[model samples]
Target: MPVFFRKIISPSLSPNTESDDVWEAVRAFLKPRSWQRGSAIDEIEHWFKDYYDASAAVSFDSGRSALYAILEAFGIGLGDDVLVQAFTCVAVPNSIRWAGATPVYVDIDKRFNIDPKDLEKKITKQSKAIIVQHTFGIPAAMDAILTIARKHNLIVIEDCAHSLGATYHNRTVGSLGDAAFFSFGRDKVLSSVWGGMAIISQKSPPKADQPMAEKVKSPPAGEAGQKLRQIQEKLPYPSRIWIVQQLFHPIAFAVILPLYNLIIGKVILECLKRLGLLSKPVNDQELRGEKPLFMPRRYPNALARLLMRQLVKLKRYTIKRRRTVAYYQEVFQSRNEIIMPKSIPGGVYLRFPILVQNQEEVMMRAKRAGILLGNWYTSVIDPVQVNRENVGYIAGSCPKAEIYARHIINLPTLISEDEARRVVAMV
Candidate 1:
């Protein structure tokens, strides 16, 4: 699948088709056998249940939708608040708002996850839950965060957007919280182009009277199971048109990236965006804190198949990412101009980040050298595309987050070893 993705990105890449069935993958990509809900969805759910040792796993159109479902299932709404860190995606807070709850922004620690001190300080009578985001797949200080959650009686929802197969103290992240959500967006830890799943923890299930989502081959049985099932029933499948738009992404990219330097690719990409044949990861409305009409829908089976294929390579991807991270740490230890992030045995460096003195100049230099570096959370709300006030983020509310946003630059961990060294040399 990785080989196929590279080939689809640009034909200029070596024609090494040794391990990949390029034509088979192409046929599967262009024409999936099942466009409607099928056994694939159940198969994925079962896979997650086994992988995380969870009771139930429900699929959704996107991570936000899965989060929304979890919020509604937990009955967190109206007069409630959800505590989340500032150095994160807009979707986290957006999901909180959509649940009729307020998102209270908290400062972050050096590790980039929420600081337990600020988290405890942010708690109020109305604070119902705490969304602990595992930034860049680095496990947050789970022991400390869980201690605070228990003291405040707050539910912890692990935002596993950047963390699939990530662990906290020898336990998997998704299984450590009350409930957790995973994103399978194009650039997330796993890519299905557009997909997500909500898993309810079985380790510490709620009281007997509470909802229990435990159904093997059939619909889940208890209140939680029935509630989520009902939510899915009310939702509709992604429109065929939108599905085609997703399908166009790779085909469009394959033609564009190779020709990018010649200037033709730039025009083609912009034209495709204007023609609505390509979709941005986040649309204009999302940055403004408004949900798109197209979203909050059910996960499509076609995308589920894509996700299943990615599942096959999960082990290899994790191994390569860790190896790359080790190499980065080894080379960067002697450097003084930059501050490297902490390296741990279980953390997955989705994109390795380091704090630099001048982020803008570093990015400019990389661009000049013909290297494209990752720029996530360029601002507290991310991509420099979000409007902070619209998302209810006060400028000075989280000082540490703001500082990280300004100085942090990321190195890609999801590329070839050759590519990794090349990027390191350029930086």
Candidate 2:
């Protein structure tokens, strides 16, 4: 008999009382000109402020936009340098460049966050800010980071893109920084399809006085359909794995998967897009290259309402993720082949990342067993296949980050403890 593995992660799509209430709220709010000043966006801002204990909150079209806005709000542009972790998503560097500031890469520590020692060493007179990313929701050493930033008078902006609901030393991740940003993209802890929030602390520097652009129309219906399709695509992992296993040869598996993904998957998705069954995914060019002064329109009302519903059950979701992390911890504790990051005081585990030798082979075996593992930050900066030099990254500049990039693979936080253990046993 063949074994079938369950999905590693699945978006929370089940509806409840709160979801029903949200739909009713949206329906009532949809009346002609019902959404005025104190509406969905304001409600979300208030929710974030109360939840994170933040003084001020702002929403944006995307998390990258939130970071850009924060950088611009503090006037960190043109000739300024912002230090970021070398092992973060490419969007971090892109946001810095979008603000007309240079991004200086800093190496990561055992916790996979920016190394405070390395961060201090990289500071120059040109260094205006530090974007401390909590990689995979593992909180960085805030005490050390803050000490260095205070001594150097550098702005501290926490990239809570992966760290929503995460904490550092009993304090929420967003509240500890001068300013912070959260992403609500597809895979985020509190996804609203595609949205972001910025929390401005009381001690944050004076923000720009310019008002943001007016609200635009809601996101296209096709966008929701596209997200649905994306979820559907991940559902057939067993079949995908079986197909790959049948190929036998590594070269054939490598060549065929890409070709199938590029040619067959692309054509089907494009057809769906043309039929209005799905929307075309946003490409890198579309996301990047906005002017330094460019300000995106406000978050949509419908999405804000959707996000508010998710917030109602955020605690439950976080608890489940924590349980999964603990399961992985227990299983991998005695295994010398796998290395887990040191536990932070109050960190939330977004994805249970582990370092192993022969990561490619491990991942291939996991896939062949119908396991869906997370291949996050496979490169120093993500989209690993892209040339590092093109993104201003120099090879060997951050050796530790490069090594981690090569060895890291993440376990799903959305599965049950039993499922997690099964994944470990298979590995």
Candidate 3:
């Protein structure tokens, strides 16, 4: 009875719990001076290294910060343009802008990632980075994106915010790019509740000069955030945590954040000059930008940290989602107006996107039946002029993406197979 689609999916609901191995690790982390010794950070870093097979992993206050941090490390800044898919969450463009750079929107392929052909055409002298996003848990076309990045000498930043355990061509999404970010937020495949991890490719670090990550000092001057982190570090992962996580976000945005916005807001929220109860925003410059907040707050962090401990169950969750997607694919495969994306052998289903003729009507009907859907992406990020002239092209450009976006209803692949069958019947 929480608001269905209006309510964001809480990743905590998945059956992830801390194992004895992880519990022992956390016990060690909670010892005195744990912060200074870097034991806790090291545990997380090593987890990332082992899980993602990356050379180095760094944790930031949140995922968006990780994105901007990597951008800064790579020397991307003002006068540089990063091509991004227009249909992504606001965070994608905000990440580019936060790094003292601009975002040049591009169209996507039918799969909801950067269209390789379009990406090749967008390259210019000022172009510096290409952010390839795995939208809604579907892996982007990494092979093509990598080929283009290599030809242009552009830095590739893979936004694995959606697809954490997903793979492309037998390689994990996080390991395929030069650098990548993973969000362990409420609705993600992995729920750290509110945290993010950035992995530097095994080939090299962001640049020669900067150290991977600065050591986070203990007794963290920010009393509120530190307390929250402490509590999170102690709690065991729980499915019920999703209830609290789902209830808190809109409240935080509406009530708590506003209070921060009024006084000492800049320092506490953005600069972390003195962390109040919130997570650190990217930089002082981020506060000055035209976007909204991009970091986690008290509740998300507590739940997220607890959720990270739940990741031992990822393989199980991925399997369930795949089974659900498989059923939907069978039902909709022959429907002319709709498109059901095929799951590649290595790829797992994040959300099964389907194209339909009357998206609006399908959404209404699906909602009436307790089914929820998404616009995997709304539109490709092509520039305004191109968007207008290509309006017709946009119409057919990502036929599958557009069809999926327009009529594609994302049912809860999170539930049982019976629920998936019911969803198909109702749709």
TM-scores of the models, in the order given:
0.89, 0.77, 0.68
Candidate 2: 10-residue stretch with minimal lDDT = 241-250
**Candidate 3 per-residue C-alpha lDDT over 1-427 given as tens digits, one digit per residue, 9 for 90 to 100:** 3323222221222212224323433543344233222344456657877888765576654577668766766667888888877556555676677677877767667776678888888778788878888876888888878877766667778898878788887778888777788776545676543567677676642232323352111121123223333433443332333324332333333332324324442233354324333332233433333444423222233333344465766888789887877777777776776665656665556666666677778777765654445544434322211232221123454344443344554555765766666677767
| Model 2 misplaced regions, further than 4 Å | 1-38, 204-282, 286-295
Candidate 3 residue 215 C-alpha distance from true site, Å: 31
Cα lDDT tens digits for candidate 2, 359-389: 9998888766656577777888776654556
Clashes of 1: 0
**What's model 3's lDDT at 396?**
52
TM accuracy, model 1: 0.89
Candidate 2 TM-score, C-alpha based: 0.77
Q: Pick the candidate with the highest lDDT.
A: 1
lDDT of 1 by residue, 1-427 (tens): 2321221211112111112323323544566456656777889889998998876788998899999988887777898889999999898898888889999999998789999999999988788788999888899988998888767667788999888988877989888877899988877776766889988776442222323342111122245555666777798999877766665555556566656645576689789878877767788898999978877899887767667777877787778778988999999999998798777668877778899999998887765544556777779987588888988899999999998998998877866777677667877
lDDT against the true structure, each candidate: 0.76, 0.67, 0.57
lDDT for model 2, on a 0 to 1 scale?
0.67
CA error at residue 37 for candidate 1, angstroms? 2.0
TM-score rank, highest first? 1, 2, 3
Better of 2 and 3 by TM-score: 2
- In candidate 2, how many Å is residue 154 off? 0.3
